[model samples]
Target: MRDYPNDQNLQDLQERYHLFAHMDAAIIDAERDKACPEGPLQDLVVGLKANIASIGANWSAGLRHRIAITAQSDAHLTKRLRDHGARILPGLNMDAAALGGGTDNPDLGRTANPHAPDHSAGGSSGGSAAAVATGLCDVAIGTDTLGSIRIPASYCGVFGLKPTFGLIGRSGIVPLAPSLDTVGILTARAGDVWPVLQALAGPDGGDTDSQPAPAQWANQTATPDAQGLRIGIPQQVSTVECTPETLVALASARTTLEQAGAHVETIDMPEWNPAKLRQKAFLMTEAEGAATFAEALGTAGTLPRTVERLLTYGSTLSAAKLVAGMAEIRAARVQLARSFAQVDVLLMPTTPQRAFQADAPAPANQADFTALANAGGVPALAVPIEVAGQALPASVQLVGPAWSEPRLIRLAMVLESAF
Candidate 1:
């Protein structure tokens, strides 16, 4: 088995993504008390977002404890994790405003690209991706409005799942794009993804958006194994900044699956441009986030600097623009839905590139690949295949229509097994 080194390994992991806030030694203590726990996850430490509301140590507490500037522990989520016999470690952070800078929490600050530490880990969910990739935690929970979850997963080279909207509860999580916001998970492998998903998903009475998910153990009747799997790869998505190594990673995976008797098709979605769709997503999310925080900002209370600026900018948005953006988003969603109807699963580059250096400053443009799912309200996953030379990690994104999470996961499971 391949083992990543531990000398600065955690720090190296911490630098790769921006979602983790802090680690809770106490959480580990709590886990040790459990008897006959589940397999690997029985003793796993999971990171969460700072905005999740919990009764014990929270984002504010993390700051004071000097554990993390952005790591927040949701009292509610933490309590639930305990009830389920799981431990809640510290929360992770995105950039100050959950904007472009990367992970939050100044002390735990932005994650360095695990491979480099100079580039970005991706946003909002950067810490979560970083934590999982570096083995800081078995799995981490993140919130996705635009590309918060998927982008960082891509950049950091890991597996991330954004379930269909409303499948997972959002009561205790932070709000970015309210309508678009969904709880997501990041992990090292597909098997790990399902376990965390099982724990965190399903309807919660506390969250209004929570809806009843399918039976946990029952397999969806429609999706079969890789032998009968029909996958779509959008041609347009490949036109992005994908390098030879990245392409090889995906191509090799595709070839292996093909050899295993899975059906692979090159899809053409002339209407799909991940970059353009993401721009609209950004505007819509910022506008909605502005509205969500309007009251808080109206007061003289201070928010993280990035959040403050985001709110201020949102304040400037006109109702007309918001309405127009929604209309456009709706159209895009319809188009994407129609596209998905042509195939059971769609695959694309999780990120156009790989991880950058940990200590490096923010790049000019970020969150490009991860925004499409948010715009379309579809379910997606980012699965890492390789951490090639010079670059740390690279992954492939699998997309499915809304409410198709079960099917998506099954497919991901096959891919996981193949790899």
Candidate 2:
């Protein structure tokens, strides 16, 4: 069994980084009793985002007023992890109500990037990625709604997998956008993602969004050959104003995949405008989030002003605007599906830049490349790129069709081995 981090080290790290929103001996003990000695994850320690439900732990979802709300039962995925022998930690910190890209919460404070203390750990799932990056936990579970998981994973230089939509059950997870919220895994190494994914993925009767595994995935192997793989790079990616380092990292990835016998081509996606689509996704999230948290909003002082303002805007959106946003999102999904017909996978930069200062205002385009996957209901894997002279890590993502996690993971492994 892998050893847990020493208590002193764990406490010091948490103090310095503000990694957890709620954690204590009680939370640990509650999870310990559920561990199965002979299970596959018997030795693993897992951390969950504040929004994911774990019985006996606080489920604040980063809201100060909601801090008293404790989960009455384990979420479907949490139960599976315990059954597989993993010990759950208390909830990690996140952006207020999971509405932002940076993990600076008005209630929970900020999660510092393990790689660089002054920099932001990418959001909603920032605490999850930081825990894995700093060895506080072997794996961390996070919710991704428009790059929440992958963004922090990139900033922290960890492997984050946002599996195909509906591939993982979402019961007990606080809903951000019911249509886009997905539970995903983050780990220090790429190899760790597959096993954990295998253990937690399956249909849950309680989660209406849960999907059954297709027959072809039953016996599918994680080892996928790169030869003859068709890789597509959307033409719009080249036009995006990425930092020089980010662009270099992306070029390196393209070259590496090509050298590995994967056929790389630039393809046109005329209907997909990342910046515009991202706005549409934001609107959907806000509108859906407003509906989900309607009751909470009525109680003044229950949430921060920023969160209240965003949700209020969402609540007041005209029916015509909401319908238009939904229509745009549907079009994005169709555009992505059509792109998939020509390539086995779409490769692009995960974020347009590296980790910025925690105190800095988040860029508006952070989710440009990632939101489409959510809108399209596809799977995406974000892996850190090691640039020769750069101190901060750059990252890229591989997007595939719905239920194509195995293929995306396999290809990610190839890139992992090469890096």
Candidate 3:
């Protein structure tokens, strides 16, 4: 299980990639001693994104004021991974308070893209994606309150899965918004995802949001046989907004899936007005996040500008507006369910554009497509797809009905083959 690096070299890797917020060799060794005989993630080096709790690691969600905070007990996800024999290398960096898509944390150093070092790694889970893409670890666990996992994976040319809300318990992690937060994984390959999910699924007595798993939920296979599957490209994604490069990548992926025997169709998702949905998602996320960080409200001035702005915006929202926004979200979910009734999956570019340069202000358009998954409480997978002449990676998201992780994984397997 100690296959990757010695303690000294792990530090070197961490510094090279800005992948970890805090790391401890002794804690990793202790977990190895207690590791179960044979489990899903045995011998794998897994990087836990900084916000999720690990008893001895820094649990700061990349804010300067919280840098000294450390977890006294393992988060539910941490315990599950250790029991399955996964070695926790170091927790990765995230956006300050996990509010943005860029992993530009002023507290911990920015996590750079392995493909293009000067480019941003999509975040707030940027470090995890960077770690996996750069071979610093075999896999990494990350949270997605709003496209954090998938955006970074897309930026770093790796695979990221945001499981359905409540599919995995959220007992020990810090919350950006409990209603939207979910634990997920970033890996080098599509085939590596299901095992980690298997180990983490099931109700934890602690998390009030935990849900029962379906029979054989973890037994679903991710083989590359996509024959006869219906793949729907939403009119929203197919028509406008995505960058020319992202659209090209999407076209290539669609063609590849068709060749693999999947039936492709263009479907109308008129209810999903990107602009309106974006506004509603912002209102609800910021409001919930403001409440989540209520204790830190006074210290908001110490946070990164973007994060502070979000918290302030969230705090200032009218409760009546928030309530109305949530009602629209519920109705949107129902509409999404009806659309999926005719198609097995709805596909779109994970972000409208690729990762911006490290120095650029994080783009406002980054989360336009992905927050829908969080709002709808469905599963979404971001799979890497290659562009014709670009060195960086672009990706498309595969979204399925709630509890349809198995199906999404299988589709991701098929889509990833295009690269």
**Cα TM-score per model:** 0.82, 0.97, 0.95
User: Comparing candidate 1 with candidate 3, which one achieves the higher lDDT?
Assistant: 3
lDDT of each: 0.65, 0.87, 0.83
Per residue, candidate 2 scores C-alpha lDDT tens digits across 181-294 of: 988999887778878988898889888988987886846777745789999999999667799988988998898889888999999998889998899889989899999989
Candidate 1 Cα errors over 4 Å, as ranges? 1-41, 60-77, 104-108, 215-224, 299-301, 357-366, 387-391, 417-419
**What is the clash count of model 1?**
42
List where candidate 2 sits over 4 angstroms from the true fold.
29-35
Distance (Å) between predicted and true CA of 237, model 2? 0.9
Q: What's the TM for model 3?
A: 0.95
The best candidate in terms of lDDT: 2
Ranking by TM-score: 2, 3, 1
Q: What is the Cα-based lDDT of residue 365 in candidate 3?
A: 70
* Reference-based lDDT, residue 377, model 1: 70
TM-score of 1: 0.82
For candidate 2, give the lDDT of residue 136. Answer: 86
For model 2 the TM-score comes to 0.97
Candidate 3 lDDT by residue in tens digits, 349-398: 99888878999987777887888888898899999998878889899899
